[model samples]
Target: FMPASLLATGSERIVSGLFLGTALSISSVKIVAMVVREMNFMRRDLGQIIVSSAIIEDTIGWVIIAITIGIATHGRIELASLAFTLAGVAAFMAFSFTLGRRIVFDAIRWTNDTFRSEYAVVTVILAIMGGMALVTDLIGVHTVLGAFVAGILVGESPILSRHIEGQLRGVITALFMPVFFGVAGLSADLTVLVDPELALLTVALVAIASLGKFGGAFIGAEVAGMSRSEGIAVGCGMNARGSTEVIVASIGLSIGVISHTLFTMIVTMAVITTLAMPPTLRWALGRLPMGEAEKKRLEREEVDQRGFITNLERLLVVVDEGVVGRFAAYLAGVIGAGKPTTVLRTSGESEADPVEAAHLDEIEKGAEQGREAAKEADEEPAHEAPLTRRTHDAPLSAEAVAKEARKGYGMLLIGLGRAVTAKGGFSRRLNEVAGAFEGPLCLVLKPAGVGRQMPRLGPGSGRILVPVNGTANARRGAELALAVASVTGAPVKVLYVARPGRDEPRDTVSHRRREAVLKDIVALADRYGVEIETAIRSRAAAADAIARQAGRNVALIVMGVARRPGEELIFGETTSGVLQRCPCPVMLISDARLRRDDEGREALRSGTGTG
Candidate 1:
């Protein structure tokens, strides 16, 4: 219907109507993103479909508009011109997704490490976008497609997708978006409505575009297994042709594919249709009830949105050249894959010092191995983001570490010798270091090497042991353990320490409490797709119970402990004893007080291995 009506509108300019029609048919991504976010349905099933379809529509619409203009310039859609348009588009898309994807990811990662300066990555991304846009223009397609593809690649780079998003979003929202939209409005003359013939033609044009877009989206939804009601809601939601339509019309006018009269009509149609969308979408969405699966998925995503480890952007490792340091590097590698990481060795030794050099080498080796493990598991890309081999020879003092910590690191991984004193109290030096940082800390503890254990299983895979005692610290420990296990696809054991005889007998009450704790841990592990085994040990000492349970199968033990004020991280007896005697490595995840003001970035303090 749209094609026939467009054909009927012109004799000399047959493809002009086609260009205008395509421009009018596009649904705006900016409009859909705003409305869905305002309604807080951005993560809903239908909402995602609508946004995704808009992205596709925007791409396809630009391609069509570009080609139609080319045909209009040549005065005819010759067979050769048609073939060239099809081939150019196909080749452009193929290169964008394949080799272009790799080049973009690698360039972004390289820029981050080489410059080591702020916004180096942002500079690289913009350059890539501009270069790609020029390439598209040279190929006779619209620059918008190139810019759009560049955005996809930039978003995929894990170095700082979140940080980059925050930075770019602010710049675009505060400056670029308003300027562009405002200029578009200024260029559109609404006085064209005074001409009755043009006004009637404009009305007909809008009607054809609206009905066609609405019907196409509705049919697509139904074909993709959505209900009839969902199809209706999607159609209503997609009727907006706001900013994208305006941009398309502006481009067409500049290229002579559309006249001032047609551009004004299209812009007016865009304003009317866009204004009509939000309320109609709200009403339609209000009638579409949420399903159980969607509700559960959204709830899970909400939990992740608030989670600590889930949001960690970068890592800073302050360690010594020891078994603990190498192990710390390994953990950081697994957890910090595709994230910027800086490793600092505190030995304060010269490059000539063999021990210092060996420790640094070992730490980097372990980190590389861990990253490989993550890559094999498809957890993240290897050698992307801040994959640093640059270890500073600087002193591991609070002043030294804190200076680096202030430079945009979210988590600090501290590994050291003598974390616990002879009396089972945290070493004063550890506290002094940990006191400097206000961010969360992961203290890596190297376990006692009691017996020569057998090496088995695949690379980066290991069994993790976590002790649960219904404490917040314990939950944090289990959370960390679950994350590691999830990344490495390792098995986890959740051991509950039941004292020798507390008289909380194995009756229904005690049993139920124990059951609840284990159930919670199991559920947490399940969320990460990690396999877990639960156990209860009626033992005299919690530390001894946990230590004894760390058999040959367990590769690491993660303990969560609260920090007691004064001078040290006081874990009472259980944690201190675990540090003293456990045969497997113990990682203590402590919730440091995270302070922040109005800015989105976090304030971090210097950290030590005791916490």
Candidate 2:
């Protein structure tokens, strides 16, 4: 009984519905694609759930569209037609799932076997997606369902899936997805829900939908016997509607089941849920100390299974003819037992062998005299006997040392000794090596008269001194000290020096701040189960304070250094000053040790010692 104009208008509406449904479906996919990449959800449990739910939402949207078409044709939805359409969809989905999986897997295998080009594999994946979409459209189901099904089919195809995902990610995440969400927001009319009753209704709908999702997921997790915190995490994760909600709202609008007002309200709900997810997830996860077993399992499955080594901690051993250097090299080899080991021998034409030999001869003569004097008299000499002269094929050179150490070590261990007196002379050369070397360095001093059989570094050996200024380089030095302490089981002495006139007066804030800083270092030492003694010294110069303290029973000093611009100084000012004055051997950690972004460290941790 409707007019001819009304019939024509109805026909136009149907056509519009088709276009709107297709566009929104794509837009919804864009939302998901964007969020996934931005949040790096590929490795997250919530991401998996979102992907699965997206599939359901897409499938349901298609079913609703088909029912809407039936309603438009018959002035009401025909139950038989609806049943037939659903049956066809179900059958098609099953066939596609089975056959499509095989097709996708075979294509991946072919790509791997043929050209072995990632680009080609990506092209093939896109072809399959497009083909599947066409077939689904021809069969009267929505294209979104086809895309969802295609994604599922390709999911198991490792080669094609990875390739396609990599290619699609940039385009989808950077441009398409954000634009689509922005457009959806622009299209929304917030004024429609201004009525108090409509606003209440919207709130009620949001509450119901959120509860349905959260409760359903929570129940599933509980039934699976998950921990209370884990169950809550799952529930909070599932409550994020986002892209799926957008797709559902779009479908409702297209089918005339929901008006623009309702669509806007639903969109708002989706945005709220999406925005709430990150904070809620963080809270839930923070509440539960993620079990070690669960973390290990996840790490194994998501990270270790990839077989890509990322984090590696290396130990570099630099050796010379001296007993201290040799011992350090041996200790490094022991530390890097299962990891990579690089043995750096400094030997080159640039290094004069005769000069070093003469110095060693002088030291040996001193040792002989000291020994004779000891045997003859009861009074001890003020200074200890020095080391002997030895010659070998390898000469100490920085480049050679670095090249050898780079083989498999993360931490660089260098011997500390004086070129002449066997105390402060070799520290500058060691610092130069630390600066030129690519990783962290640990310097070990061999005391005068200590034989080839090095004493085991332990609590009885002596106290290890760590000078900290809270710099990243200092932290690295601390890490090296900790590693040494772990090996020797030695107690650590942490010293914080406050330069009297640098900024704050020594009597006021600077002294108190220094105390607080030492407290923090002590706390950290405690965490590692090491004995820590903290001190605050007031001096005009950091080096002076540290040197004066070094004279007081500290066997070793660990200090941080950086390359001075346009200068060939082995150590930074503070470290150099300390080395020049301190009687003990000093370890200088370089800027390279503090570079947190170095992929080398990650590679080392993952058991690759390339750095």
Candidate 3:
């Protein structure tokens, strides 16, 4: 304000300067995110801090802009009116973040589940944004603040998958955003800059914006205990005004607080600063050194990028009202605590089977437990809303499940009381359901005599046993085990199950292979921030070793097995042995392969593999 006052003298000087200064004070969050992503610094400490600071600045900057507009609206700021406006703004923000967020989440979930039309959720999101914007406008503030709050609320919903986010971003980038910037750009005329006085003023504006933002950010970074290199990168990063300046300047112009000349100057400063940010920030960040802790964190994050459990976008649970179903729900809740999980309750063989309220209650209770566990672990539930959706549209059948499978599920979980037969093989009903979904699946089977003794598998319940053979399937199972342990705080025991004849000689090569496999599992545990105990047992059948290690205290045994081509759901001799002999509940995660019919297998063997 003092800098702009050098050129102005009248009553309008103070208000104009306030508007222009506020416009220049904010940084562009979108631009910062793009640059960070481009530089692959999004997961780094410095990158996170820079992005978080920009977000906070943008939020607070919008509120200040609203208040300034409120003062301008009243012609001359009266203390009573100003106080009332400030109170209203605070109340609105508090309500939006607290109760209003819940309302928005519920609305989005309902729209997503109830509608069969495409883009129904997106439609409801826009309506919610418009409604909130109208409320803010009624409260004498700008509509953008309300829209911003609504976007945050919608983004927090658990069901807002990356696909939906891309849809929204696509429409904005393709249509609305281009028009917005085009109009803003066309309004600025370079002809007015030919005047020497205005040209000099524009230069002065750029200098002031750069120096003030850089110095303030550097000082603030140092005060927060950041190193000198980090402070320099932050200052350089925050200097870009970009879209934010255009928005504030446009608002000021529309409200008659700033003239066209001042608006053009602000836009020009925005352009120059934004153009200069990338190179400067890159140079500044290049000088910073990575600590040992940061390097380890980056390695873990890289593992997460290629992990199976971490990349599951959605989960489907097929269950019944029996104990097995309830147990499956509990495990599903833990595995999918951070993803959207849909529960499809089997109403029995007859179409007239009633949907049991008890089953629905179990699903909710299990999901609640999972949410609590996630919160206790300080794990970020990317999508915290829309925990579970229950469906009972059709009776249990191949056709019914096949229909649901078309909706794109990453993984399926099946748990029914009769899923296993007396011969310890998968029952016909279980095979039917499993064949309907072609993706990866986990089958929760109840051991003989488990009956009503199976307790809720939650935090501190018991130990988890994972058998590893150093195969891709084994690693996948280990990853799932680690995820579950991370959420439930269960102690994990990774047992290296060596084949009886293959690992006979404990030579150097064998020892090195075993060590490498165990080390890989340990690294996976670190990715999920879980500690585990390792055990190596050889010169025994893989199934026998696994069953012996799964003692009474072991609550669950999770194994990853590959599906063999056959008319039924077959998982080789080893998996069958573990399923028949292990006392605890077993979770079998199978590879992405469906059972091939007899004709298909015969054709391949006879050298006539055509369809």
Candidate 4:
């Protein structure tokens, strides 16, 4: 800046230097993420730190660039121009994050739910981007600011699932990225570099850009108490300006803030730095070894990647105005935590019922509790608002509920008062509701004598009993139990019932498999920051073992059962025995598979189905 300003005659010096420095100082978040991902470091501590720093830098740089452009357009710095630009940008940011964010979220959600057209959400999102960009232009700033803000808010929306994100990204990658880069590339004239003076100046620009970025990042990392290797990796990671710099240079050139020669130099510097970063960053990261704790954390995250409960995008809760209904809602809130939840109040529950109001309050409290626990356990917990609605137009029916389920729910939870019959079998209504949704289901049942008061599911209540049979369903149940226990501060006991008289061979496949199952559950509990006690019963029957555990200070029994091929809502003998014998409330999680054979239909018509 000093050298460039001194060389200028008078007025152009300050603006030229500021624009030049701002252009050079910018770091590209896209390039940083790309390099980090290529090296499989996205989840590691080093990669996270590097990527986060680049994002912060990019955000701040854009703001500075906006201010610079505002000044450059005026030909010189003026208090009124600076003040208007700063005030407009600040006001826009405040509104964007507050009311604007809420409005956008609601709009996107409504579009997703209301539209049956393909790519409706994507269409709405693009429109939102344009609207926001127009707002920034109206405020006398670049539209990119508004577009950037809109992208952040939209990405944070809970409904923007991985599938939808892929669709959006696919469109952008296929259309926008190439077009933008191609235009930017065509605007630059590399022939300017043929002159010896210009060639030397470009080299100087690259050196200045790289050294400034690397030194700043290295010093900052050191100040932050990072290790030497980590600091080196970060410095290398931050030096890539990549496509962000190209965009910045284009903006500068478009607004007459920079000449074509300088623009070409900036673009050249960007290309060189970006192409050099990945290999350098890879080398630095490879020299850094993972510690035991980091290794464990990585393994836990891997489990989470494949775990059923962890990957659930949204929850569909169908509950009534009963104790069981409220409990189910509370459980749903806990398990779904920061994920979007749609609570469909079963028809026939009075809208003015005090129990219904209480149920809503319980859901909020449960969600808050789960959020707090997540804050303690996760480095970056999601803060998405849960979505809830009720239907009073029609009574609860299989067809109506299934219609709601078609909107892409990860799991469905049902808790109706008449879920069980006098003969201890699942009621006909319960079977119909369960048969409607073809996904995982959680059915909550309140015991016969339990009153209107909510059960103490939190601390001081008792332990949570989760029985794992080494199946995927059983592991899912364990994950659900862990989530509840994490929020409630309750101890969890994993009960594994071994077949009696099994061959007692060490290191056998069956034995190792059992050990592995228990080990996986333990790792899962550790991930939730919850301690669990494991119990193995080799002699007692599976049901008896589970029932006995339920009696020992257990507040609730959560079981994962496979749907049996029958007309009735049967989950095999073990589940039935435990449900009949367990003294506490039992929650069953099962896949949505109903064997609807001709004989099964006749059995249902004859009302001759068992639980």
Expressed as tens digits, the lDDT of each residue in 20-67 for candidate 3 is 778888999988888887888888999999999999999999988888
Candidate 3, run of 10 with poorest lDDT: 2-11
In angstroms, the error of model 2 at 17 is 25
Best by lDDT: 4
- Each prediction's TM-score against the native? 0.74, 0.44, 0.83, 0.89
Which segments of candidate 3 are over 4 A away from where they belong?
Answer: 1-11, 311-314, 338-410, 435-439, 447-452, 455-463, 469-472, 487-491, 495-517, 529-555, 562-574, 591-611
**Model 1 per-residue lDDT at 19:** 76
Put down candidate 4 lDDT per residue, 328-403, tens digits, no spaces.
Answer: 8888888887888888876433432535466567777788887787777765665757567775445588887887
Candidate 4 C-alpha error for residue 236, in Å = 1.2
lDDT of each: 0.72, 0.56, 0.80, 0.82
Candidates sorted by lDDT, descending order? 4, 3, 1, 2
Q: What is the lDDT, from 0 to 100, of the residue 307 in candidate 4?
A: 84
For residue 66, model 2's alpha carbon misses the true position, in angstroms, by: 27
lDDT of 1 by residue, 420-537 (tens): 5554566665676676676778987654443223222233556788888877778878988877776556778889887676546456677788888888777677556677888888
Residue 374 lDDT (model 3): 57
What is the alpha-carbon RMSD of candidate 4 to the true structure?
Answer: 5.5
